[model samples]
Each structure stands twice: as C-alpha cells, then as structure tokens.
Target: GAGVSQSPRYKVAKRGQDVALRCDPISGHVSLFWYQQALGQGPEFLTYFQNEAQLDKSGLPSDRFFAERPEGSVSTLKIQRTQQEDSAVYLCASSLALGGEMAGYTFGSGTRLTVV
Candidate 1:
C-alpha cells in the first residue's frame, strides 16, 4: 500500500466481545507501531515491531491486549472481553527505519471501537 491502512473504521462491541483491528503498512517499511487513544487524550503507544520481530509491547494495558506482525507487512491488534473503558481509537503507523525524526511514521486513520 502507499500508506498505512486500517479496517473496520468503526465498531460497536457488546461488553465482553472480542475485537480485532487490522493494519497494512506501506510496502518495505521496517518499523510498525500500534497506539490507543481515548477521547480528548493523545495516542498512547501500545506496541512496536521491526520486521517480523516484536521489539516492544510494554504499553499494552493488560494480558487481554495483543498485537502481532506475522509476516511483517501487516499487523493485527486484538482485545479480549471488551469493556466500556476499552472504547477508543486504535492507530497504526509504519516507518522505514527506527527513531530518527518524529515525523517519519505514517499513521493510519484508526479504528474507532465503542464497547457498550
């Protein structure tokens, strides 16, 4: 893809339902990231992967959250047993290299999940 892409632009999940958000990054990008954003708050980093290797996942809120880049080109974020507190916009981003310039990441439009 020319830029990052995310699916299910909007979702309304009943409490306790599991949800999966997908991301497709620009071709050949090496670094990918996932973030969570609550209304009125900035995006918070959830995970990062370099190629097929997951380099960091310290920001995930709990064991209920997981992210992966199975082939390194696409990624998925899964949240189990969705809760009202889990409602937020999930963003995905990709970059050619690791940290250098803050503007290097190309972010996806995000998947807005609402747990009711």
Candidate 2:
C-alpha cells in the first residue's frame, strides 16, 4: 500500500504562472480530497471525489484552483494565475469512502506551493 503520496514536496512559481501538483492515493480507497493549508491555519477543503466523480468542490478558493481525479486513483490540483496568497501546502487525502465521520482519511505530507 502506498498510503498517500504527493510529488515535488515543494514548488516555487512566479505570479500569474500556472502550476500543477500531483497526488496518489492508497489503493482500493474510494474517496479522495484536496486541501490547502496556510501557515498556522488548519487545512481547508478544496474538493473531493468519490471514485471518478467529483462529489464536492465548494471549498475551492477560486476558479483558478481546479482539481480532478481522472481515473479514480491519481489526482491533480492545478492552479492558474498563481498569486502570493496561493503560497501554501496542498494536501491530499483518501478514505474507504465519503461517508460517516470520515475518521479514516489518510493524508499525504503535501506539496508546498510557493508563489512569488
């Protein structure tokens, strides 16, 4: 089992540039979620998918932030027109399913996106 993994661990981008971060969830998991964490703040939900269907995205900060789980396992979060405010850690998590208390969500170390 790969747990959950994110690539680049860190990223530096110029303002207005676009960036894409990647995530790989644990095998057999049925739910995936993306979150953003600012310094000293808790993770804020960005979007979620059950299998290949995006079930929720209400927490996406803006239209520039987009996420997708194309094949129900690997996911990507793409930010268009990066801004300084977008500097933060992007986290990915997965669970057996998006039900109940979500107590089994496993999180990755995250990709730290820094926009300058």
Candidate 3:
C-alpha cells in the first residue's frame, strides 16, 4: 500500500502569491489530515477529513488557507497570498480515523514552503 506523499518537497514563493500543494494518501484509507510545522516545532493540526467530508478546519491560520479531499482520497491544500508567517513545512497525513491522534496518523515527508 502506498503511504502518504506530497509534491515539490519544497516551495519558494513571494509574499502574495498563491501556492497549492498536493497529497496522495494510502489507497482505501478513509481519513486525511493536513498540518503545518514551523522550524524546530512539532506539527500542528490544520484540518481533517473523513472520506470527502471535512470534519475540522479550525487550525487553518487564515481564510487564505483552503483544503479539500473531493474523492476521499487525493487532497490539496491551497494557500492564497502566501505570507512570510505562512512559511512552514506543510505536512499531509492519513489514518483510520479523521481526527488528530497521538499516534494514528502516518505523515508525509512534507512540503517545506519558504516565503519571501
């Protein structure tokens, strides 16, 4: 089974550009999650989805951040007008349940976004 994976592994953007990062989760898994991790910090939950339904999005820093899992499998996280404060490692993860767990989710390598 293929685990979670993200594209571009790294991203560089100007302060007001839009960027989209993609995530391909393990086949047949019903759960998906997104997280943001700053330098030297643990990953923080951004949003979660069970199948195609978004269960939570409270951790998304601003309206500029959006995410979706349309088919219950592949997901995308889009950040509009990227900000220097938004620069961080964007991680995608999946699990059996759509909730952030102390141990259930398996993390992607992450897309490290650096804004200037």
Q: Relative to the true structure, how large is the alpha-carbon lDDT of every model?
A: 0.93, 0.92, 0.90
lDDT string, candidate 2, 1-116, tens digits: 66899998999999999999999999989899999999999999999999999999999989998998889999999999999999999999989855625567999999998998
Model 1 lDDT per residue over 7-116, tens place:
98999999999999999999988899999999999999999999999999999999999898999889999999998999999999999877826568999999999999
Model 1 alpha-carbon drift over 4 Å, by segment: 100-103
Q: Which lDDT tens digits does candidate 3 get at residues 2-106?
A: 678899799999999999999998887788889999999999989989999999999998999999999889999999999899989999988875354544888
RMSD of each: 1.2, 1.4, 2.0
TM-score of 2: 0.94
Tell how far residue 88 is off in model 1, in angstroms. Answer: 0.3
Worst 10 residues of 1 by lDDT: 95-104
Judging by TM-score, tell me the better candidate of 1 and 2. Answer: 1
lDDT of 1: 0.93
Query: Lowest-lDDT window of 10 residues in candidate 3?
Result: 96-105
Q: Rank the candidates by lDDT, best first.
A: 1, 2, 3
Query: 96, model 3: CA deviation in Å?
Result: 2.5
Point to the candidate with the largest TM-score.
1
TM-score for all models, in order of appearance:
0.96, 0.94, 0.92
Superposition TM-score, candidate 3 onto the true structure: 0.92
